[model samples]
Target: MITPLIHYIQEHATFPLSETDISLLEEAFIPKKLRKRQFLLQEGEVCKYIAFIVKGATRQYTVDEKGYEHVLNLCIENWWTSDRESFHKETPSIYNIDAWEETELLLLPKANGYYERVNIIPAFNEMRIKLDDNQHMAVQKRLNMAQNYTADYRYEELTKLYPEFLQRFPQHIIASYLGITKETLSRIRHQHLKKAS
Candidate 1:
């Protein structure tokens, strides 16, 4: 069940881990299950856990003053999802995270000393920097698209990059993620299908 976490770590680690290190990792993680529509974190709550999805899907989002949801990220198998600032600083989160499907996760609690253990890994710094860099680049790309691309263009780009997202997530959720109205997303999908057919 924790194979996903192990694989992600191994793939990103700058140096190979020994059996002892593997045992340490296994000891540090706690498995959790979330039913569909269940919230892992809510706005204004301090996020204490960072979860690695072993199965199912989740969405991280925030609601505006007018109560419109704006999705920040989506996670499926092998993805990590968390309210980063809240987790690190023990501050209230602006984001909410919920399971989109019945989800299994390996969670690391902030007070568990997992970070100290992880830091001892030979390539920990390298792995951390790489993950941070990738996330920063992804955020920049999304910001650029939001500023310059039409809803249709952004939807197409998202589909091209994550072909299964359309099928995996509800249209309304996808529309929110793309910062578009559901009606607009429906129109875009209809037009694209018509063109294809």
Candidate 2:
């Protein structure tokens, strides 16, 4: 039942886990699934779990003072998602996490032999390095978008980067993730069509 989980982890990790380490993870990790658009965490709520996506897509987003949503990330299959500030510091979250499609995730308890058990696993440090790398890359990407790109270029980058998203998520959510209004996204799409003609 957990072979998919193990395979996903192994594929993503730079260091390999031993059979015993794999066995220990299967015992310690709690598995779950959420239907499309279900909330995993809401703003002002405590994030109680760290999740690795086993399948499907989820997003972490913030609601503005005017109650408009601004998406931060879209976590696809084999990705990890969480309200990091809340999950790590054990504080109330400033963001909400929800599924974009029917999703499966492995929820690891903060207390569930996390570092202590996984430290013995060869894959542990590899996982940490990747996580850090992803976060750093995300920051650089966002900065580039803010500093150098037009909204249309950003939209194009997104489509190229995550084309599968078009079939799964609504336009407004994608627009928010791109830091543009839906109207702007519509205009951008129109421009793209014109150029392709």
Candidate 3:
């Protein structure tokens, strides 16, 4: 399980972790499981771990001052999750991470101190930078899309972003992630389906 993870990271951005590097990572990580709705981190608590999901799904969201819930993101198998601000600065989190289904995860601390001993492959640093850059770009796009795109375009882009979501996640969750009410999502889906037919 861990081997493919290390290999995938190495191949994607040139992390180039040798067998030893991979093994060291495996040694430090702890595996944990959560039943549905279990929380890995909660609002106002310091987020200490960056988790890699090996199975099931999780959602990161927050309740605003008006009591409206805003969906931040959903993570499935082979994805990593945490509040980036909290993870990076070691501060209290503003978001909550809850499992949508029963989940299994591998976790490493943000300041694990393992990176200091294991060589920082230049490629690995680049990979981390690229991930952060891409996430920032995506968030910016999402904010603009919410304000500017029609419900139809938003739905289209939602499919483009998470093509597997319709089949994998529950519909209401998908609607929430798309920043729409379930009825709005239903209307958009109906329109799309009618056009396809």
Candidate 4:
């Protein structure tokens, strides 16, 4: 479980982590497991931790007044999920995060100076900076796709970039993530199959 996170840190860190740095990480990250459909954070709760997925899948979403869930993000193994505003500013989150499958996570909590201790490591600090930049770019691209691109184009890009999502998630979830109706997603998939055949 921890090995995956250790590997991720090693891969991302600009410098090699010392033994002490590894020990700090081990101490800081608390391992947690979630059953399928279990909520990690619910709407109106302050998000106290940032979770790194070790295995399984999770989705971050919001419910409308009519109780329809609008998917904001779909995350899987090696992905990080949190409401940044809620976590950093200690505010209530409008979004909910839940596990789509039985999941393992390493949680970095806001309490006890754990985050501060970990960030003090030069290699970890560098990795965090890099991750923030990548996350920013991904958010910008996703916003562009949502605001400007056609649904078909968005679906195509999703297929190209994260084909595993098609296999791992249900059609309704995929449709929600794409901001399309399930019927429209079915139609688009059928059309693609026709073109392929």
Estimate the lDDT of model 2. 0.82
Each model's lDDT comes to 0.88, 0.82, 0.80, 0.94
Off by over 4 Å in 4: none
In model 2, what are the clashing residue pairs, if there are any? Answer: none
Query: Which of 2 and 3 is the better model by TM-score?
Result: 2
**What is the C-alpha lDDT profile of model 2 across 60-135, one tens digit per residue?**
9998889899888888877778887787788999999998889998887767556457656767657667777988
Q: Model 4: per-residue lDDT, tens digit, 1-197? A: 67898899889986898899888899999999999999999999999999999999999999999989999999999999999999999999999999999999999999999988988998888888999999999989999999999999999999999999999899999999999999999999999999999
Better of 3 and 4 by TM-score: 4
Error of 2 at 148 (Å): 2.7
Model 1 segments more than 4 A misplaced:
123-125
Worst 10 residues of 4 by lDDT: 1-10
lDDT of 1 by residue, 62-115 (tens): 999998899989889988889989998999999999999999998877776886
**Which residue pairs clash within candidate 3?**
none
Instruction: Highest lDDT: give the candidate number.
Output: 4
TM-score of each: 0.95, 0.91, 0.89, 0.98
Return the clash pairs for model 1, or none. none
Backbone collision tally, model 2 = 0
Stretches of candidate 3 above 4 Å error?
65-67, 115-123
> Relative to the unseen true structure, what is the C-alpha lDDT of residue 190 in candidate 2, on a scale of 0 to 100?
89
